[model samples]
Target: MQESKWWKNAVVYQIYPRSFKDSNGDGIGDLQGIIRKLDYLKELGVDAIWLSPVCRSPQDDNGYDISDYRDIDSMFGSLKDMEELIKEAEERNIRIIMDLVLNHSSDEHLWFIEARKSRENPYHDYYVWRDGTEGLPPNDMRACFGGSAWEWVPELSQYYFHQFSVKQPDLNWENPKLRQEIYDMILWWMEKGVGGFRLDVIDQIAKEPDLKITNNGPRLHEYIRELSKETFRKGDLITVGEAWGANTELAKLYSNPDGSEFSMVFQFEHINLDQQPDKEKWDLAPLDFLKLKQVFAKWQRELYRTGWNSLFWNNHDLPRIVSRWGNDKEYREKSAKMLATLLHGMQGTPYIYQGEELGMTNAEFEIEDYRDIETLNVYHERLEKGYQKEDILNSIHAKGRDNARTPMQWDDSPNAGFSEGTPWIRVNGNYREINAKQEMADKGSVFHYYKKLIGLRKTYEVFADGKFELLLEEDKDIFAYTRTSEGEKLLIICNFHEKEVPFLLPEGWSGKEEILIANYNEIAETEKLRPYEARIYRKA
Candidate 1:
């Protein structure tokens, strides 16, 4: 591995522009506020920041559906503000990665507008469109947001394809010319000194040529490999795919040097603790622990050969892992710290979302309080489908990933000090006690643990790119893995449960030990991890 590349062993902090900070006091966050807080990010000890999206968008999907690729939305600051932010972040040794939503464009995009205008229009071929056979969209595929994947374009009298919201139409990548358009835009931003892009829904981007879809179809990788060769070359950029269905073999194909595509791929399978991989098929029962241990162990062992995994517990799109995976009522704090220990101490690059450092969790919200377009749409769709109102509400409570996207907590003041006025969305009620201002002051706080964890990655070379070997995988609720490099080994042991557990160190591996990092209530030795406490034992 190249030691100089900024992306390697780097920790990424994701910022949702609308919820990060508000300078205008309009109850919405903008660029100038982020500029003022550069030092704050620096203190968090992250290598880079990835803003959700700041482009011109209808925000129906809250900036996921881009109307203009090059222009900055007015809600965010101007293009000049972005340029300045880049310069400011560079000064702090912090790189900025952008969210590249290339899978689709907003219905209002000029290209989409023209495409809908007439069948003979040149822009008509920019998106996927097909002739309707019998007053129905030509396929059985369901949209991610819960409806038909096809929407009728009355102006052109044809059906356009969209894997997500109908307002966001999928681009035709099979058209080589369209592929070039995306590549050109990528280079356009790279020229601006932007570091890289997190490709949204990469697995969904490349579908089969025959357009066969029943949940998931085969031949997905064939198209992705072809697309990778055409767009992402060997050098000049780093591409991280939001790949959902990638197995270890495919991961290696995309992440390895000869893999042709990107640096790493985000497989959410490990994070889907209680989730049914397919949404159309929701399993109401709670997750089985033995099943989870097997799942993660299999992934850790299998994916090691081909590609690097993207480790994370919370992001803009999912509910907090603590509340979902960990027993929130019984073991909130230990569970949070245990989850962190499991993720950060792993072999791959870890991404810590803005409030995740403080062990921030899902916001308690009434069904009516949700502002997420997708959640509301799902509720309505389920209701219209004759599902019980109670069942729909329960699904929202359990499966609503938007709960994690709520605004960050900066202070105990109103709106968590996010703004002087009402926020675009309500802040989590626990913000008063859980804000960054408070965590920075407290010694044993979760925020402090994050700072120490980040420092460990930078200070210890082994923790960053070290070899991870899964040990004691059979133990339920205890995730023990060894990371070693240069003949030195460090064992990371964590008890995921609130109850205490004992562990036996490997035989013939005795050495002088130093505690590099721990997440326990009171500090303890490496022989046994207390409750949610995790200890990293260093060899001397």
Candidate 2:
């Protein structure tokens, strides 16, 4: 029999601490800021919070590069503050999940600092290193952030491998000593009472730079299984890996029923539909509604009873869903609710980004307004290739990471109530109308709609263990599906476009249905769905 998992039915909220709230007026959100807002999250009704990295770092990649695994960064808070945050959250019945960047560490880390001093240092084997060929890098492989993947050391006369920024050196997982160190660090955090971990860039850990392989390496699962046996299996923990290269076949190995690896993974196949194949994310392509529906249906069916899924639309590294897939201007509230219904009605754990529940829209940023490292690198790289500045700006507006990093809009006050002083990043211009304070007061707002959607997941048994079947597989405008369990059925229909679309009830699914939740207040009994309309019906 399959074992039950707490995270299976729980709704997780992802908080990017730097942008969530500022408590000390230092323009950056800190641990105390999150503590002050614990009541707010408790009222939102999330079961867990997945926080991005808050460990000690040089902020080269905005905290992904960890300099110390045992200590919290001074910028965020001390160890006591983190302990207090965890204790306070537990009192509110909410679990805390930390982000673990195991693939690399900051160059300033003591191990890396020692390893770079000399090739014969005791910590030299902690990182990947190679001898230069003809005074050049061992290979022509480029880094993910637009540079050589190997950085030369003048004193050592060798190159250290880095899949991301030069300041972030890739760790050598083949070393059992290094792996044990990582395991011990994870256990230390577990001892601190963390509920789980979100492994960052986990798929690239077993990479072979010499063979030009970056993801899904030969020993990938072997490493993951070993890591699981060493740490997570010791506790009832939830582990979700960020695997951009995963498909249904690989997903089974990562999140199989045997509990060998992770509980689930964050896949990007659906998120990549709008980008050109085998190209950078900035290479744009029109999103096909049919293709999007087909991808979701495939995962929902393939993972049923065999593994699990993680349903989400927005995160710290992507654009807002309302801006990317829905009409962010006129129908922001309606479209946001529609997208929420589509995701929450699925068979998986749903994650809500910090500002997403309030129907946050993308920022209208100019070149000077951008602060993300990836965005600035892409902008300069495209400009050097003769691409028009206007075109690059448009792409950034559509797909930049900064779109999701803007301060959370708590109210209409200056800086969106995120900070008393100047914000590190500019707030979205529509905060006056879309802030959370305004939504919580209005019953029909997106914030309340999200609350209802979350409540439905907790109340319905079919949502956690039901058979999923796509309703309108060939329909271009209406994305519909059904979930059935123990003779109870849920019909969920969503209009993908900004125009009214005809929705026909499947045979034997009409007249006996009760409206569970909807974005529009008055859903007509007629066959037409208004612009960005979404509705869920329950029948026994």
Candidate 3:
């Protein structure tokens, strides 16, 4: 939108702060450890780093359960370390974006502590609390972790709302004072010279005072748009919202810089591929190829033209895409390279989760090895509900948020060398072969391929901020799109299927298309793609 649209060319690398590296050798990652890796990150060719969450917390949800807005968790070092990191990262021309967990805070947080003291406490209105309705939990709303949204607090003699775990109480944006507090935290972080934030469960915020007590309640954005005006007005502060139900229309409401709060909002439709069928209406639906094409097709076209889509396949919450969707073990290099080509070539800033470039997969662990608070609670609760352990395991296999939270695979050493001693979490079993050191050494490693993708975006502006025109919009096994600006045109052709299939070129798309990069092998001037192969071409 301006002469300095670097974000278009930006490659944002995500660092799970607890597993990134630990300077303290306490078997946990800290801020100083991140500082040590700044040079490596600069070489990694990222425009910025999005650190998950480093604020003060009891860490029930890792650091998402922030206990203090203004202070750094002693586990992550001091606020002074954070300031130093900002300076160092800026010096390396790399910006840092911290996670803004505004939806909730640890129950131990001062505000929550004050609010829970008594129903008449001055801070009581800062969180959502209600007299239980008809001897039941406050509402039928499902917590993302599991169970009802209301948690009975004996101290308050009533239930306070928690859209997540009981330790993390949802903030009441309905309270003007709480909204001001959020704004104050944003201003504080910005004043410290940090680049921006990735707002956690951001859409869960600005709860509608008029929110009907029902599933998919309406009028959430009416409140969010108003909150955007009250806060998030600074320039160059790129904030992205974590919103699962947002569409192009909702994105415009949150990112329409003329007034909205964030630079972009995450659209989780494509990532919900495992849940392709509506559980209530359809099962074994074959993921609806036409619908699949339509999903990403509509997202790319609508969000690109309407506002922006936060394009990503894996995050800290989901299992690694290579393992969950693609053939990381069987196809290995081919699939990892293919996925990288397809993802980064999309219309938004690409986020590469730690160790993903190495083609890392879900850890093979017995059910007992899992430590996610939500997963543990869900298993126990499900057991008490008469569900078979197999059924519970299947759910964990399908919906385990703990899968991606495993420690980063840095080397073949114990704990993946993520830490000197045992890590807070178990390392994936495939760590020896699928570690970062090997990826760096191999010329054909996924790490270098990612570097190539980042290089392509920076060296060629045609890949960024260009118009996206999907070809063969009806293809069930193929995803094809063209990015063009003036005389420059690039075709991103990808085969999502496992078997090799002949691809039909789009009308008026022919005549010596030079393949710039290929996932499987080099593409002839005019030839077909290999299985799981992807090609980027410029028409001659």
Candidate 4:
């Protein structure tokens, strides 16, 4: 809540533990595996690590289905391993942030298990339940993963709400006792030295009795305020909420200057700019450069003083950035570096997903190769409707979540040096060319460029706390911006296209400008930007 919090200066790195590295030779990443990679993260210069959910689960939706919030899953080692990871990460000055899935819990969770046994059970009200029969759901709302949002339970002659899968039941925030239980669990983790939490789909936590409507219910802010006051507020903690479908206005309300709720909220406007409206993730469209620029500009300018922005390009649940937005085949390194420059140059806390620094691309696997439950469900559903196999596979290749879920490319060894045993999912075939070991060895690599970008953020106050102003707003191929603070100013120019583009200098800025950082060695005297070229100029 303070003006000078540690998280404000952090460059967060998100680690999908299952794919980060396998230490026990079990072909899956664990807490101990993360412990082994602490030094690597420290060397990369990230200030915080956001580990996805690792609590006890049925592995139905990876670790998002939490059966026991207090204990660690055997697949991810134990509570002791997590404690050790916290201790080790603290030693390296890297704060550890847990992914807190507050919206739902695994069906196997004790509270959900007891609640479904009988209507009169003490825990019966912990989850949302309604009386209904099979195929006659209580509402017409579709689950995010697909199908109806309600699942029938024969034992209690009711249907429980599950916005994701039937195995994960949505918790009832209306119950005071249920809310208390969540707050207590948060306090438990806070006491364990966990720096903070990345709240999973937190806006969806507070919902109306009717399951048809989307987020932003009547009590959403109220519930978040109560949760903040009761749990994380007692300790100095950072909270970033995954606010699905949130816009700049709503985001400002969730994270105002008063810190009533979260430290910041991850808005989806930029990420969803390429998606076809009202269509599934597989349905795609070309990203509107103008719209993308507008969205970023709006967030930066609107949230300048009151709220903060969480800048990112790739995450565990999305396709790789290089493959999605850059020329992954030809200009992979250049474009990846350029994107990094553009993102880190902005006035926000940047989050680098694992392998992003190495210019890792999407895993263009076949239909049968996917392990994501959502992908499989959609694939089968399309198959039954006589949709061509090749068409479905093409969509999967373009937009499937599994594209970003591939195992980390540590080195060009067996299984990309990710594990000694067979990996749970196939590694990207390009690992041989783009691995951390190779990038670390090459001075002119994406990894080093990221290191430079992060160093710039740490050393310059303009990039972190300066006011943002969008430049070249009408330029189709060149994305430019300026950051101003006191007497210093930073000018960032990025070529989003693959061809050469002319960038005219702004008026009164023709004076001497020092090049702070760039993706290429030589700057064009003619003011022409090469393909995917990014440059940061400073004037003091």
Q: Among these predicted structures, which one has the highest TM-score?
A: 2
* lDDT agreement with native, every candidate: 0.76, 0.92, 0.76, 0.88
Candidate 3 vs candidate 4: which has greater lDDT? 4
Summed backbone clashes in each candidate are 1, 0, 0, 0
Between the candidate structures 2 and 3, which one is better when assessed by TM-score?
2
- Candidate 4 TM-score to native: 0.97
**Clashing pairs in model 3, backbone N/Cα/C closer than 3 A:** none
**Which lDDT tens digits does candidate 1 get at residues 64-157?**
8999999899999899999999899989988888898877899999999888889888888888888885467786777877788888866567
Q: Could you tell me how far off, in angstroms, the CA of residue 510 lies in candidate 4 after the best superposition?
A: 3.2
lDDT of 2 at 378: 86
- Model 3, 54-147: lDDT tens digits are 8888888788899998989998899999999999999999999989888888999999889988888889999988875445775577676677
- Order the candidates by lDDT, highest first: 2, 4, 1, 3
lDDT at 452, model 1? 83
Cα shift from native, residue 297, model 3 (Å) = 1.0
C-alpha lDDT (0 to 100) for residue 481 of candidate 3: 84
- Stretch of 10 with least lDDT, candidate 4: 1-10
Clashing pairs in 2: none
Between 1 and 2, whose lDDT is larger? Answer: 2
Question: Residue 492: error of model 1 in Å?
Answer: 0.7
